[model samples]
Target: MKKFASLLAVALLALAAVSLGTHSKATAADKLPAQVQKIKDTGVLKVGVKQDVPNFGYYDSKSGKYTGMEVEIAKKIADELGVKVEYTAVTSQTREALLDNGQTDLTIATYTINDERKANYSISNPYYYDQVGFLVNKSDNINSPKDLDGKTIGVAQGSTTKTSLEEYAKSNNLHFKYMQLGSFPELAIALRAFRIDAFSVDKSILTGYVSKNNKILDQGFDTMEYGIAAKKSNDQLTNYINGLLAQWRKDGSLQKIYDKYNLDPADADDE
Candidate 1:
């Protein structure tokens, strides 16, 4: 009996050792493919951006080309890396999916860094700070988010601003109908035509719209910082992008991009 018990103990110890070894090997195998290393090896940077969102990321109508502050910044990063830039238009809902599926290497869209998104993706240092605000007819009585209660709020579909509005409504128990428009241009049209009582988006974006059509709407609110997003496990890519962003901030290239569009450079705070 004593001999059998000793043998059993030895067998258990060996099994445990084998299990641990297997676990360690599996963990090492599960590490994400290094996207930055691959990009560097290939010498091409794939950037995803928005097709619309003036002064930030948008397509020029007259020029029939995509141009915005983020576009220029992305160009600079590509230039510094000495690689060709491949720009792809990405919607808010598809941004994370594209990165995870390896369709794009990085997203330069106006992605707001939040806890929920950070859990699934990596975000670089903030390139711009803007408030969550409303755009209403200049003559409308609505002035703040609180005033939005019981009013229809129009937001661009799949945007962080839309999520923020939903969260605020839930937290405050406010009852407001949220209308998700397909695009920023659609939302602008809806607000102008009174199809929705108000439109909520980034202050800078709303300001850009107002600048172009001053007689119709007014800027109403402010929010938090926005950053570029990459895949969560792509640590190498994340670090490389963060380094580039730091250099841009230090050398004032980022500010110059903001200034080129008449935006306040102070708004581009990493914090």
Candidate 2:
């Protein structure tokens, strides 16, 4: 009877040790930064994504699902963290505000990695590269960036593309007027209606909007690096996401997602 009791005691002690270790791990996780800990505790990763841009991110009304390369990337990150995804629609103007206000943990809305953004928020390494391009009506006969001289171009508000376009014009001694639209859909309509002679933005964003009359100009400008942005204060979460992106790139998962969306993975700058 004493021997049996001794064995039971040892087993109980071993179980207690395991429980303590498990608790310790959980405690450490909870001690992480507020954003990371909240995600762990809530099992939800709130993400901001564009609802209109195709191949990057879009909501299909027919299927009632959001599907695209950026969406896929967001889902992969959530899966890696063992969390559920909750997407919030964001436009170029609203992406930064949503992240700063804690409405979203990550913004994967084809966000450009630029100097101003890096100073304001934590951004992941470029997952994709996009060159600026001009989308013009086929009837407009614009074949080059110089053709945009004295033309009114439309761009999304709160986008770095507008600044880039202006700089490109100034550097080439080409003068043009640019109108800031509220959204991408509006830009497309303006361009089609001749309200704006051209719409300048990332080439990838202009792909799905292309029609027989509207074509993406072959004149490519400087390449812009796109990155996932998080709040500047959430370093832990940003680092975790960066590490996740690194793993995905190495394992070919990122490339597969890009391919599934019909985007060339070769365009991604893993650096």
Candidate 3:
């Protein structure tokens, strides 16, 4: 009787351990959807982007299609993975949320990877470097950000550019009235109409805007590097992307993409 009771207890304990292990695995598996898993399973890639930020990511009015440096890179990544690519358009505020919510597999928008974002998401290797800069009308007499001390500056809402501009204002003991626009298009319109003294955004973006409308605006200021963002838990996806980025960097494919857009490329040697 004593032996039978000990055997029964051991059996129950083993069953409990197996049940707990199964439950833990199920819980982790539930974190992301089968769609993302399907990407891994079928080797298809899904990328998220902004359909408005020109030259970096945007829908061409003439072609009525999405095309840009980022789009090209996304295509290259999908090709390397031997997968079909699916793109989802996301806003600056919604990009990470979409990734966290598993709505998209990867974000190639000019996402700046910072310590705060690192806590919530994994960032792929830096594929491009951009700094905050100002765009002013050529006739505005604003050669640099310093000239905007007492003028009104326009920025898109929910952008790192806003924070960087504010910090710059505070640090320099400057006082510039800031106008928050809902999108880059609106900001450009406002700048063209002279509703604001200048518009501030990533240097690459400002360069693109100026390139498109050199008659109206010019680049003025510079801020930080940008990277792709993925879920922090997706180590497999993150590693794969980082490896691809490194490969692109080594073969000059990354530089070619930037050159196509007339952007100054940065590499490991760049500070």
Candidate 4:
């Protein structure tokens, strides 16, 4: 009878452990929105990120790993969900399709938030602010916006840089010829080859490509907003990210990430 009692107690303890684990998981899921809860339950968060753009979201071949401010942000979000992060490298041209195809649960690809993008997907509140800037060969004597007039500028394909620069040129009474490339490296190569006179993008992004032969112009324009994005049906996920962004912005976590990489986002007039 004592042996039977011992076995029953052991079973009770096992049952208690299972109950506790289930209760804890339920409590965690209850704290998150439906989309976010699904991430927590899945044990992995699939993120779309850029493999270029240096400090923003670059993959380092030397380390065989991804490193950048945006990558860190994605890791942080995965931590909040208690999941491992799986990163898929994306380009400006491929990020949206990855989300639409459900290959990625979120995009932290330095995705610019704009009216058209917001209409198609759920974009969280802006986490970073930057302005359009140009990178040109030092020998070209293209020091400012006016110098780009009638110049063939290389822009990343599917990026908003061309539109922003066009507006700037229109207001300043200048004209530009643009060439679209698939990546920043391609644009840089074109600039080096003299195929394009200038390579234009976000000032912060331009900082990553600066070499002794090329430099970012001191002037910038069109303040752009960068935000995390999810599928059009995932408003819950977007709201969850917005809450984290708000908390991070309040607690200085976001600024700390920038400082870790020695990044200073350029303002409209700040050099």
Candidate 5:
């Protein structure tokens, strides 16, 4: 009886060791890059996106849901990872900080890829492309950048649109005072209230504001390349996203997503 009890204890200890080994192997598969591994382990992907700018990444107040091209992209990534998604609304001023400070795992809020941004953040290959444009009230009769002289235009702070608009104005010998709004929604309100004569932003963003009373200018300007952003030096996360983007580009899945928003597929290609 004593010998049998000792053998049983040894068998139990061996079984326990095997179980721990199995668990370690299971978790080893989830040891992706720190950022991605966190999502895998937590089973949730936190994405930062714009709460305004329809057809891009707008939060529908009526539905309490977000809808747009970038939102679709974010959802697709979450689905691919077999994880649930949580979105945090962000503005131009907050998007970079959110990613840099680890408040969000990724940012897909129509983020533009530029040399300055690339120097500080890891950006995926271009997923969508658009040109700078102006949004003006129909009553303004402002048809061109030349007409913008002496007018106040609203632009999002820390956005490429601000620099692009200023460059265009300088090249055209037109000067306009700029009101640095915090986000697209604020700029829209400022325009409607006559606090600003126009809103300068990307054509994709301006398209969301088009209506009988507002129109996106016919002419497009400097090109803007949209990318998914991660923290700088996060090569594993960046490469993982780039690989997925490459596959989506080849599979027509990316175009289908753009089509769902009634966006032009031509404008949704990698550069």
Candidate 6:
């Protein structure tokens, strides 16, 4: 009877250790920064993403799912926080507004980090680098930016493409007429209808739109640095995200995602 009682006590002690281990993990959020802990306690991470950007943040109607590099990044963040992720599709013009209005905890919608924008939000280090390129109708035989001088150029309304192009044009002694569109698909449609001579945006974005009807110009301009953005008040959360980005970049986990879609970030900085 004494021997059997001793064995039972040992088994109970082992079970207690396992329970303690589980409890430790459950309390991990208690150690996080207050802002970061607040996010984890909410049980959901609301991410603002782009539905139309393929290989970055595309939402498929048939699959009812979001797929792409940026989408996976958001999922990784949610996983780290041990929370469910909900996605809200945002456009260039609406992304910052979403952050300002507290509609999204983070905007991972290929948001380019610029001097002025950084002043208004907490932007992370550049996650992806890109440059502006143009897509023109194949029949137009538009060979270069110079070829489009004095012609109509369509850019997403809130994007920096037009201003960048204006700078490039001025230095090269060329001029372009500008048309601001609400979305990329709308810009492409306008290009197809000959309403604009060229559609310009990030080269990786242009890659998704290229078809037999249109071709991307070999020359690109303005190095664009894409980063995740949060409301100015979420400094701790942004810092937490920066830590994740640093870890992924150091471990090559980010490159693995880029490889999955055959994306080449190095080409993004081409002139």
What TM-score do all the candidates reach, one by one? 0.77, 0.86, 0.79, 0.89, 0.84, 0.90
**lDDT, model 2, position 212:** 88
Per-residue error (Å), model 2, residue 241? 0.7
Ranking by TM-score: 6, 4, 2, 5, 3, 1
Q: What tens digits encode model 5's per-residue C-alpha lDDT throughout 1-271? A: 9999999999999999999999998787666667677677789888999988889888888999998888888999998788999999998889999998888989999899999999999999999888888889889898976788899989998788878877888888888898997878889889898899989888778878777888887877777888999889776888889989999999999889888888863254322
Q: List ranges where model 5 is wrong by over 4 Å.
A: 1-35, 265-271
Q: Model 1: how large is the Cα RMSD against the reference? A: 14.2
Model 2, 23-103: lDDT tens digits are 998887667667677787789999999999989889999998998889988998888778899999999989999999989
Model 6 stretches with alpha carbons more than 4 Å out: 1-28, 267-271
lDDT order, best first, reads 6, 4, 2, 5, 3, 1
Model 1 worst lDDT window (10 residues): 213-222
- Give the residue spans of candidate 1 off by over 4 A: 1-34, 167-174, 211-222, 265-271
Q: What residue pairs clash in candidate 2, if any at all?
A: none
lDDT of 3: 0.77
* Pairs that clash in candidate 4: none
Model 3 misplaced regions, further than 4 Å: 1-38, 61-64, 211-222, 266-271
Per-residue lDDT of 24 in model 3: 97
- The residue-by-residue lDDT of candidate 1 on 1-271, one tens digit each, is 9999999999999999999999997776445246654675678888898887888788777887778888887788777666788888888777778998988888988888888888988888788877677777766666565776899988887887766777777887887898898888888888888889887787777766673332323333335777778788876777777888898889988878888998763344322
Top candidate, metric lDDT: 6
lDDT of 1 at 11: 100
User: What alpha-carbon RMSD in Å does predicted model 4 have with respect to the real structure?
Assistant: 4.9
lDDT (CA) for every model shown?
0.77, 0.87, 0.77, 0.90, 0.86, 0.91
Give one clash count per candidate, in the order shown.
Answer: 4, 0, 5, 0, 0, 0
Candidate 2: misplaced stretches above 4 Å? 1-34, 265-271
